[model samples]
Target: MAAPNTSTSDLYRQWAATYDTDGNILQAVDDLQLANLLPSFVQNLRSSRPDGRLRVLDLGCGTGRNTKRLLLAPSSMPLEVTGIDTSEAMLAVALEKFPEATYHCLDPFSRSSPLPNDLRDSFDGLISTLVLEHLPSDVYFSTLVSLLVPGGRALVTNMHPDMGSRTGAGFKLGGDGVRVRGVSFAHGVQETIKAAQNAGLEILEAAREVEVDEEMIQRWKGKGLERTAQRAQKWIGVKVWYGVTVRKIGDRED
Candidate 1:
């Protein structure tokens, strides 16, 4: 299969219109994986400050599906939260869902482009869900480091290249499908910790899990005989979700 070189911003803008209503919306395999992962991260933050609010940032927040979970109860926070995404359309949906929080439509991943100076290192905690895999290897580390303040915590999750399906598998071309131009890096537990460590972010916890929904599996099987799916289930779990909480330990000057 020929790899497509589609811009993340453009692809998301196209996807935003129907993202929430898609079959893989509420209990989607990927969404469910994230829903399970974030609460643990929140609990870690609460442990640090038992009786105070913690600032948080949700980067590459698409339509706020994963981000919304943080805004809802038991995972709810007693702090200010902000989200940034490259697609305004997706951000619009996020805005509708969580009008109380601020949302920015910008590419925070660009090294040359910084978030508004005031927002720099302004958050106490940060989380990026289903977003890191979209970035190239070097950009991934740079983006994480640039966004953190000293002692701030970050939790980032991405599609597991070794297990979960890559961008644009079942969908048709130019039809709001995922776009991945070959694998720049395999996003797994070790790489996530290593990236944060290289960025001077200390890892507090790291784990990987795969939960395959029988419905999604049947859907794929009906579409075609996906050998990757078959091979993965033989040994590896179907869904690949990873969560890492890290803190910035070094001075910014270094």
Candidate 2:
């Protein structure tokens, strides 16, 4: 029998222990994709705010995976960054790595609860990486809409549905590890765009799909991630992830 899937909370709680060290190839690929978009996002965000301070949100900022790089990226505007997550355990790890940033938790069980007033439509930019595949399309984009200022830009990356349909946002357990996936919803690129549009956001840039290739396989092998290298072999020439740059499209009640 296939191992039972772990609950989202349980999966992240346990996964947090080794999340960063696990040599996750998806994160490596995602980091590059998001990194390419950061300069534009930072520059555009700062231009919109006169004080030259960039208020950025790392929505689903897991284990500071992308946050560390964002904090380190060269930016003329000083950044005021905050992170939100559904797992306290994961948040604890993030805090340990990035004590300078503020962190908040939204009850995963009560996702409908609104964020604090100060957070509503408050950010100049947002980054959500490798997270959307695990969420229902509406919930994911709606949450992004809530966190951005009108006209704010966000860079969102996710496991391509082609890939998510095979595997999802999950990791193998600590030992003889059983792979555990959270609730993964298949979301095609058009479906994602449609959901965002419905949530009052518009795609500023079309989806950029990334495929696995031989260089990635060799890179993983060089990193001592033999298992990851082996896995990528099966995915070569496959679209593994996609990203889109978007902006909040309409006026929203803050």
Candidate 3:
């Protein structure tokens, strides 16, 4: 259960090589949830701009997992895609895999960071998947709110407090299996909702709570991740990830 106290950027920089290959059960659950969630989200975006003029932003788009999905996802027109992350190493990998999409190495959460404003109110849709735990719980919704255009939709996902408080995102390093834990704050569901309300974002109805199940466990085992399978087996019926759909309505306070 021991993990290093490394910063989020440095940790992901080191883990970028193995990230996509690792049989991460939570991310697998997230993928399953996204399959159901994307249609409605895409419909909402299309409803806003029927002419197919849509732009999307991906926050913490590690190795362009979801970004690639968006690129390949069926669309009326070529959807403009942009992704941002704090780690240049991860972004490098993302850029190589999906060279069409723009990538920025920036962290919006840092108060001293001066570059995020250039992106304000710029996107038609936004996605920040499983990135909230590394950020301050209070500022997440507000920051997300600022980056979107009025009436624009967003999909946000987080590591659920139930599982995160016990053991959040961590990865084994090298042959020693030295675990390097991502910087995390396990925000509870109520607290997360309260923060969204405070940010004045319009919460949409198509939210999701992803739980570990037999299918996820079987996937891990089939992928040669016996350790992960054993861990997820104990978490059956327990929610490990939460996804929320919210909109940037007429702007109020940022």
TM-score of each: 0.76, 0.91, 0.91
Per-residue lDDT of model 1, residues 67-138, tens digit only: 777776363446577888888998999998888778888888776776678677676678887677677655
Q: Residue by residue across 1-254, what tens digits does model 3's lDDT show?
A: 46767888888998899887666778777877787777677777777787757889998898998998778767777778899998988998999999999888888777777545568878889988999898876677878877888878888998999899788787878624778887789988777777877887778864567788898788767868786687577789888999888887784222
Instruction: Please state every model's RMSD to the true fold in angstroms.
Output: 5.6, 2.3, 2.7
Please list all clashing residue pairs in model 3, or write none if there are none. none
User: Considering lDDT, where higher is better, how would the candidates rank from best to worst?
Assistant: 3, 2, 1
Q: Give the Cα-based TM-score of candidate 3 against the true structure.
A: 0.91
lDDT of the structure predicted as candidate 1? 0.64
Task: Give the deviation of candidate 1 from the true structure as CA RMSD.
Answer: 5.6
The CA lDDT of each predicted structure is: 0.64, 0.80, 0.81
What ranges in model 3 sit over 4 Å off?
219-231, 251-254
Error of 1 at 215 (Å): 9.4
